[model samples]
Target: MKQPLKVAIVHDYLNQMGGAERVVGVLHRMFPEAPIYTTIADRRKLLPELQGADIRTTWMQSIPGILRRFKHFFWLYPFGVRSMDLRGYDLVISSSSAYAKGITVKGDTRHICYCHTPMRFAWDFATYMEGNEASPVLKAAARLLIKPLRWWDRATSARVHQLVANSTIVQERIQQHYGRSAPVIYPPVNVSRFEVSKEPPGDYLLVVSRLVSYKRIDLAVEACTRMGKRLIVIGDGPDRDRLKRLAGPTVQFLGRLPDGEVVRYMQHCEAFLFPGLEDFGITPLEINACGRPVVAYRGGGALDTVIPQVNGLFFSEQTVESLEHALRSLTHYAWDSAQIRKHAEQFSEEVFIRNLASLIEGQLSSRNPAARPAVPALAHKKKGAVL
Candidate 1:
């Protein structure tokens, strides 16, 4: 009799809900029995889908105030991840943007890492810290840690048996930073949760994202404020105060809202605004699912998802002038909401699960040829070619 594979999942941490965490949620659904290991988890911040997950935390979880100040302990993550006991799992899948990929595995246990990107702080300290408002002393301390962290990050890239990238830009980054070639797998978006609105699009523009400096929410805030366009900004982070100060009378900040409320905003907005570069921006697809177009900066993952004049339009530069031009150009473009929504459906949750499962089964078959027949016929399936 063929035995079932013992699979376990590893994530950098479950301290916040975002696109990466959503990817973890899809993974949990795919391998429901798989135990999830992480450095720490903040229960209050867990998404609804992850509320009942079998999450196992490391020693870092017990540290006082770790949940609130996790970023301060970045240096300890490699040690915490390395300390995990993953000896028995037949397959260990790590969803990492950082230390989760550094876990130790031995013997026949194969490790597959779904890398969101190389550690940004270590690899691109200047841009990662650009517009960051940390104390000078703290910034100095972080700068000192970058060189050693980069070394450790590069050294650990060799630990994984296979790597998966979320977008083409990230795939290029993996090859550039880690000397590894990874197949691109577009992450899942729950297209069904959104519906094409029956009502006509509203006059106001919308932005839904974590207000971080690197994300450049200020671009959206400033562009709208300068144009006297009504812009609604949702989500919150350290960059809120500065962004609010940049806002004019027409710009509104709604902070964090429920998913349903967010969808309501997406359904009625003139268009969704994605001003920052992302590994993969899921919110734009969510808005597209709501039958709306996006106006995004032309770079990073946006290159993969945004089909110019089809689903969304793009600005060439990250500057206020470029974005302002795109906003001005938006009024002249004729947008087809149904076509936009159709494009988003290509990156649905079902497609992601099918592609990922096929990849996993193919790897398993390659590892044990004798058990090939016992696996599903999907072993020959290819990664997502949607891009």
Candidate 2:
């Protein structure tokens, strides 16, 4: 039997329990022996699955309060990721939305990037700074930093042997920004965690997301408020306070809740409100898995999962009026919960792992021209498999 290829996994950071962290968790499970490299890590904030992993952090980890304020150290992350010694590893896989893909490795070693998006801040400078109420001084500083950061982002794209995008939008962004092509691999959703509802849907609208500005949770709050619709807002972040102030009496802010409770809300809600544009939004599918339809913005990743009058309804614009119209249409139409759950099964954890493992095996086979990988079916097992 051939020995397993020496592998190393790198992630941008380990401070949030978000979609990116979940991807890292799945990768860790697939490569249990490989150590995870990151710029900074706060074990207390990570998911339980990642808490016990051998997560090695760089010198930046020693910075005070970096756990809560790592974004302030953005300029240092490129250097921090590149400085890690990954020379001996046969393969380096960086699960990144940002600088993690800049990890330096020998020419002979394979490096695959599961790019969520080519550093959103670097590429979408105007959009990234839009919702922030940063002081003029901070804005000026960011404007100056973006130039060098853009150069660094473009320069580092050449390091990856292969690039895997999470959605078609991200795949297109990679080609447009990096001048590179990548396959689209939808992020995994733990479909088994949610069950189809036994009863009919509840009266309230549901918004389960980090209370952040760009996420456009404000649209949901404002729309539901104007319409006098009861909306349950779950999850918390820096924008929590401002969101609370914008919310009307009908909108209830639940902050963050345990996964089980979140699933419970998904099962019972009238429809899941996904107001933001995501590279590949996983929450909408998670809601679908619980047999709930979604009212989503008709752009970005929502286009991939939601079919008009199928799994969910989509609003053409990212404004309160558009979302309100979609909500009205959602109420008038009947939804098929079983079909929605079935649609979600395509993006399950099992499917993501199988497709990903197949890609790794293929890359390894090409490198070792002398011997082809044993499992050919692994590559062709599923249709609609991208990267």
Candidate 3:
């Protein structure tokens, strides 16, 4: 019998229950015995399914208030991630939006990175700094380090044996930023959990997201308020209070709720409002799975998932006026709920797992002399040293 490859899963952090965490959860389920490596984990915020996994944290885990303040210690990440000893694992799979992909492995070991995007702050510093709440002095300090961080990001990215991007835009980003090619693999949506509501949809539009500056939830609040449309916002983040202040009486903030409650909200909402550029917006796909249409920003990952006049309508610009235009247009069109749900079925969790498994197996098979057909050493050398 062939021995199973020992696998190790690495993620940037485990402090939030978001799309990235859901990817980690699926990866863990696929490799049940594989250990998970992260910078730090907050059990209170992590999914219950992930609590039983063998999660190992690095030295940064001991830093003061690191769980709640990991972003504050960005300078330490390169050192902290490299400190991990992954020499024993035959296959290392990193689910990264940041430093997890930087983990080093022995030449004999294979490393596959499911990249969300090259570190957003390093590649898009100007945009990331916008609407940031950091002190001016701290922001200035960050500005000084951008050069070093960019250099480190590019250098570390080359360490991976293979790269799998979460969307086509991310694939292009990997090529542009790292000078490497990657296959596009969309993020999984748990279509089974969300059911289409039997009743007529509610009068209110909905926005569900981490209330971060870059997410641009403020646009939704502004558009809905200005149009005098009833809107419901469900999420919690640093931007929550500010968003609440900007919201009009027609808008309601529900904060964070249980997944079941969120699903019900998705089912009943008139249309899901997605007014931000995303790497691959899974929420819009999830809303579609619940038989609802989405009003999304036109750029980035939304371009891949939200088919215009099908599952969702796209706003060409990110401004309040542009979103307001889309919302008004949304009212004029009739959406086919069954067809929207069918489009979402293409990106189910099972499809994600199957594609990822096939990709990883292909990497392993290409490495095994007994499994792969023989090629001349010169030919192999010409193909370039396999990572």
Candidate 4:
């Protein structure tokens, strides 16, 4: 009798989730029978499979209200990720925008990692360090964690047998920051859900994203106020209520919209606005798939996905002034629906599944042998600077 391949899927905290969750969702579709392992799965609200599926969680799972009350708890993720048991699994696949790839696997098990980035807070420390010097104690704590976090990131990344990144930007970050390389397998964009609307220019610009501090959605709201343009803000998070209060008369808050409705709005809108420094933004691709032009923050993943004066325009900074200039500049541009869709098709969910499947199959086929207890080590090296 032959043994079936036992697989374990690991991820970081499933609490303050966003694009990472979307990537995991597609991974779930691809490997439905695999057991999901994570630091915690917040039950307040989430994709049903995460809560209903066979799940293994760490210490954070015991804590309630993980979404609202877990500020000081992010420090637990690296240790929490270590708590997941992968003893008997033949293959371990990790979906990480953060620390999920750090899980320990059996010496005999093969590990494949799909990294979003090499842990944002640890690598992009400057973003979170501003104005953080409130006290000697707090400063001391940050000082203590910074070096350890960087050490942890680098140490665990080497444990991965192979890595696939969602964007070239992230692949470069992995190499520079983690001394690791990864192949780029772009995140899945479901082009089928979005149909091109032939409607003329609409009344307002639309921005759909989780309202995080880093998202910089407030810049768009401020720009709409100053420029006197209408803006529709969709999606909800910790920043939603505060953003609503700060918004001027021109901005409308539509909290936590469904994907279908968001696509419908995207097709009819004047343009879609994205203000974050994304690693690989799935939403911008979805908006372009809907045949609307994107106005994106001009750094990170947007550099790869958006071409100026084509499917989108890029603002130079995360400020109202830059966004206002970009929106004002949009009036002179022309776009072709076919070209936009063509650009988006390159990152469709189909391509993601096919590429990911091929990578996994290729690795397994090479690892397999007909008679073998006498096989040499199988090195799953990166094909094209895998990060």
lDDT of 3 at 93: 95
Each candidate structure's TM-score, on Cα atoms with residue i matched to residue i, is: 0.93, 0.92, 0.91, 0.85
For candidate 3, list the clashing residue pairs, or say none: none
Tens-place lDDT digits, model 3, residues 1-387: 445568899999999888899999989877778899998888888887798999999998889888766677888988888999998777899999989999999956889999999997798876666645678899889878888988999998888899999999999999999999999999988888787888889999999988888889999999999999999999888898899899999999998898889999999999999888888988898999999999998889998998988998988888999998888888787888899999998998878877787687678766855533332221223221211
lDDT of 4 at 116: 84
Best-fitting candidate, measured by TM-score? 1
The lDDT values for all models are 0.88, 0.86, 0.86, 0.78
lDDT of 2 by residue, 302-360 (tens): 88888888789989999999999998898677788899999999999888888788778
Greater TM-score among 2 and 4 belongs to 2
Candidate 3 — worst ten consecutive residues by lDDT sum?
A: 378-387
Candidate 4: segments with Cα more than 4 A from true spot: 49-51, 64-68, 126-140, 237-248, 258-260, 366-368, 371-387
Model 1 — which ten-residue stretch has the worst lDDT? 372-381
Superposition error at 96 for model 2 (Å): 0.9
RMSD of each: 2.9, 3.1, 5.7, 5.1
RMSD of candidate 1 to true structure, Å = 2.9
Off by over 4 Å in 3: 126-133, 371-387
Q: Which candidate has the highest lDDT of all? A: 1
Q: Any runs in candidate 2 off by more than 4 Å, and if so which?
A: 126-135, 371-387
lDDT of 1 by residue, 103-147 (tens): 999977888999998998898776666656567899898999998
